[model samples]
Target: MGTNTILDMRGYRRPEPGTQPAYLFPPYKSTLRRAPTKPLVLLPHTLSEVTGPVFGHDAISPGDDDLTHANGGEAIGPRIIVSGRVLEEDGRPVPNALVEVWQANAGGRYRHRNCQPHSPLDPNFNGYGRVMTNSEGRYRFQSIKPGPYPWGNHSNAWRPSHIHFSLFGPAFVSRLVTQMYFEGDPLLPFDPIYNSIPDENARKLLISSFDWETTVPDHANGYHFDIVLRGRNETPMENKR
Candidate 1:
């Protein structure tokens, strides 16, 4: 066998219909410019993609899970504790997975220069955190509730409060990116990105439920948002290029 020889492992399964958003959704204006015009060519998975190095505790710092006090001071906003598990399609726990999250500040402003100028930024909030799933595939983190901001996609178009989540299962090929919306967000109905998923039930999976059990006394509210890698009940990931 050669050093570049690919593994003959079982290939990944295809996602069910309507579970994922189409690459070209007109409502999401940005997709118009990025969506592929030609048919997508599926490529075979290589050994590097399936058996790549994974990030572990060594890559994570002590305070990486707590975004509230990541900086010198505490961030201003309603603090929230988000906890959940990463599961495989068969409902098996995916342990030691790298879960990263990033979001806008409480005022709907990001630290990036391209962020909306109207909303003020929170100096104490960098709005980024990461953690590895435990033996039970559970992970937890703290952050400020992000505020909605206008994106000018359509007339009076505003996005719902959402946090971006990225997870690496066991290898680079298992990486997935998705967004978690807060339950009962009125903006959900108007957000094209959230509505892009054809399956109503799958869309609901992206919304995190309020978890009173994880809430701290007078400190932070808790929310639970589990992720399903693949299956009929898989969570809707972002469209691939």
Candidate 2:
């Protein structure tokens, strides 16, 4: 790792406890039976554990960040551009951090087989993108607005259109990921995953804003999102509601 990467990792501060509520979190399943108990074994943080996978120049293809035209075809949906910056809690830029994203297509369906049976998969849309932050901690990509899909969590749970993001910072501990949402989506009021977060403002940060300046005429609209990995004001995941 380079000097900047080391600094960013060293600055890592785990999120505060008791902030993430249990009921709001969607993926954790509810069961009536008692859960099994397990022991906590401390693991050593060796070089392998500290550093994630490495990549080279050849690993990235041109237009890799543009999901609208993947596999030499245009996806059927309203094209949009997502732009953002990755920063440390102290307001420093995290340069060259690898950012990976995945989401459903305009049809609220994923290309994967396990997706719900009702939504049809789009042959033209792959719904994934990967890009590295620039020297100033900035990154941008183009994709379609994913639609809401039904779920079994509640009587009629449907996940809001969202993009899942992953970031690899300098160290293993510094690695973090989050989901980004579009602003003003009516579904925001009812989405449990979005509501899982205890802080209202923190949840608002996940929503992106429309940017006319970044929008291309007769082509795609523009959206801007800024990501602050961990800041002095923000802590990592918490157990408290």
Candidate 3:
């Protein structure tokens, strides 16, 4: 096995209470149907779950990490840079972690056909990107800021501007999913998904902060969002049932 093998079996810390969303958060209407009706059967992580399936740089094509330019023309909207580190519970770097993101365009519509047709689509933005974290555990991408979109979760329920993130650990089974919200979106307070996490501080971890250092002059603004795989301060992950 190579040095990048993530086989340390020290075991991950259980997320502190309220740091993660409940499987049955009623306000997030989708969970009402999908949440398990019975107690979950815990599965132990074996060798297959903890190691192998490495992601190398060869999988990344030019501009794969830059959503704004990946589809040829620049994506429409206010360009922004999102950068962060993928850290372990103890703050160790997770090198070569595959971080993927997808989101709606500035018009509050996703590129998928299932998305509502109420908003105009930007021909330039497919709104998907992936990058491998560096040896220092840092990853970055450039994209237009996503816009809020109304959903059927509640009456007049418009989702906050956000980006969806998926991180793959050593194995495919270790993949974790979460969302990143902008620092000051007013819609956040009303978003059921955002409020699903019971702890105020834990919910705050999902919001990215503006970063002057990463902001490019006359180009994209910057936001920094560090993701902790697990710990007392872990980012709220989507409930997996």
Candidate 4:
């Protein structure tokens, strides 16, 4: 890795709102009542909330970044390299961030009990992985491409192939959990979870592009994905007269 790349800070991704249709958004026949519509009331920050629950990752497993071999043998799928950097809204690197990732197997099957009967679980792949940012605020993972799976959100709702990423940055407020999708995934247009994002550009931010230069011969295909924790500024919303 060379000197950390200073990514362009223009048009950063928009944060996820609580009203996304697949998970948070409430519908008419939604058994759970929706939260009362109200403007967000920003409160003063507290010392306790600011600094608490520090994690010690000294004993992190060495195999954490290699999901395919973490269990024992190689997982059956197309091998690929997932590389990215964690940066702040101001284009500063956020070194030492803990990134936890989980995904379905190459067959689009999770190891969870709920999915046991439907999709065969790969004994060679448990589908969980993690990595910490290096001095340059960069991290990499060696894993197989996850497959798409169907969710009965609608008549035939199939989620696109994606990897779930949980980022724990310096501050408690910097903790963010988001899903990263691959570029040109045909299922993106039909998936409710992917389409929940209202902004097209914001949705594009969640997708990763393949990097031919990063591709290693006879090793794994490389995909580049950079995460910007938050935006530097927020456009205020005011009621129209």
lDDT of each: 0.85, 0.76, 0.83, 0.74
TM-scores, all models, native as reference: 0.90, 0.79, 0.88, 0.80
Q: Which stretches of candidate 4 lie over 4 Å from their true place?
A: 1-40, 231-241
Candidate 2 regions with alpha-carbon error over 4 angstroms: 1-11, 17-57, 231-241
Consecutive 10-residue window with the lowest summed lDDT within model 4: 232-241
Please write out the lDDT profile of model 3 over residues 80-145, one tens digit for every residue.
999999987788888899888999999999988788887999989999998999999999999999
Model 4 scores a TM of 0.80
The regions of model 3 sitting more than 4 angstroms off are 1-9, 171-173, 231-241
* TM-score rank order: 1, 3, 4, 2
Best by TM-score: 1
RMSD of every prediction: 4.7, 5.7, 5.3, 7.8
lDDT of 2 at 240: 16
Per-residue lDDT of candidate 4, residues 98-169 (tens digit) = 899999999899888787455677889988888889888899998899998876566766779999999887
Candidate 1: pairs in clash: none
Question: Model 2: per-residue lDDT, tens digit, 35-146?
Answer: 3346535443444544656555455567779898766678999999999789887789978888889999998898888887677878789988899888899999999999
Between candidates 1 and 3, the one scoring higher on lDDT is 1
Query: Which is the winner by TM-score between candidate 1 and candidate 2?
Result: 1
User: Candidate 2, TM-score vs. the true structure?
Assistant: 0.79
Those runs of model 1 whose alpha carbons end farther than 4 Å from true positions after fitting are 1-8, 46-49, 231-241
